[model samples]
Target: MAYRKVHQIIQSHSSADGDGVRIQRVHGFDNPHFSPFLMIDELKSVSPDDYVGGFPPHPHRGIETLTYMLSGHFQHKDHMGNVGELRDGGAQWMSAGNGVIHSEMPMMTDGQLHGFQIWINLPAVKKKDPAQYHDFQTEVIAEKTLPDHSLVRVIAGDLTIKGDTVTGPLQQTGVPLTVADWRTQGAANISACLNPEYQTMVYVYKGTITIGGKHIEQGQLALLSEGEGLAMAASDAAGVLLLSGTPINEPVVHYGPFVMNSMDEINQAIEDYQNGTLV
Candidate 1:
């Protein structure tokens, strides 16, 4: 019953990415231990001008990009001829193993446009594999309700609480991973069993939550120390996203959207994209 403690609390930074869309970036560059998992960005906009341009065609290699839409609509088209629309509660997981060119455009002009896009690194051995995509609509996602009226949406992997298991639609991954959005009400005990081998991070985007007796609120991310699980409490209505994954533990080189095992690989990727050989 060893519990994971909060190692560090990070405040998200405001940044622009993918066609200049404003977003709240939790982490990406400079943290090597967060291996297989590379970055996390939250895009939430109430103003149409803030997110209308959207992400145009772009190239990526040696990584996986996951897009989860919480509100509004997004149409995703890629070089693979995959045309997918992510509506409320839908997600698109793209494994840009070797290379892939894609674009995500918003379908709405007004109202709230919100979602998350995460970048995950690939191991050197699989870096040159063919690109692929896994799409999941809202109805396919799994969810669970705790005794205290708390709700947890299982986006990937599994969540075990007091011997009950809630599995997500994403069953296979390059590395073991778990992702979920949890909501809690009033003073409540929040618990989730996890693998001690994986790196864990929790981002509280709404309301307030406490971990290891420290309070964290909107724009804050908590890095959980190595342990088998999490056992904490939230004193108020709160919403947070929990992410955990096994570290790749290898040399990582990156330049913009391309991530590779060496400088040479990065150079090769750039050459491939420029020559229109990357798809």
Candidate 2:
């Protein structure tokens, strides 16, 4: 019956990556205590110049990237001959297990571009496996509207809003991870639950939400302590992302887009790329 408390609030900072795409980023790569979840980037822009450059072909290994588009369009192509179109509310999951080279280009659309791309660390055992990719439309991701007018979308795990529960489509994604988008249409209270051992974080991107009697505003991410209960109340319309995952608790040595358990592995990845054998 214990409610989790916000241990610390990390403010997202402005950063540019992938061919000059502007973003608000929150990273925890240096701290393994936030294992499994390496980084979260909010790709939002009104000017085409902000996101038009897009992500060019790049190599990655020993990690996973999940790109979820809230309101934008992106075309993805990989060395494996995989082609995908990431549309509004759609998502694409890529695992650079052994290695993979991919490019993501923006497709001009009618409105402002906005989305989130999350980087997850792969465990040592799964690092050597074959690369994998999956691109899905928005309808495939479980979406529900609560009686309170709050919206919920389950992307990677079971979620319960109010009293309704829904399971996500991605079941066995190597790492134990949970990701959901929750939003309130107006003044309302929200409640949810998750495993006590899992590390959890909530990022507010719209309006303001109150947790543990503390107000969290846009561009702020709150790290929570061990507990199963999540409670939030918003006086107005608000939107937030919920992320939870079991800690990997392993040594993490990351280099650029490659993440490994040791520096030797990182060096090998660089060598592989230099030799054009990364893919």
Worst 10 residues of 1 by lDDT: 27-36
lDDT of each: 0.84, 0.87
Query: What TM-score would candidate 1 get against the native?
Result: 0.96
Per-residue lDDT of model 1, residues 63-166, tens digit only: 98778877878899999999998888888899998899999887553478878888888888888889898789999989988888888899899988888888
Clashing pairs in 1: none
Put down candidate 2 lDDT per residue, 141-207, tens digits, no spaces.
9988777888888888787655677888876686788889988989887788787878988889899
* lDDT of prediction 2: 0.87
TM-score of structure candidate 2: 0.97
Candidate 1 C-alpha error for residue 36, in Å? 2.1
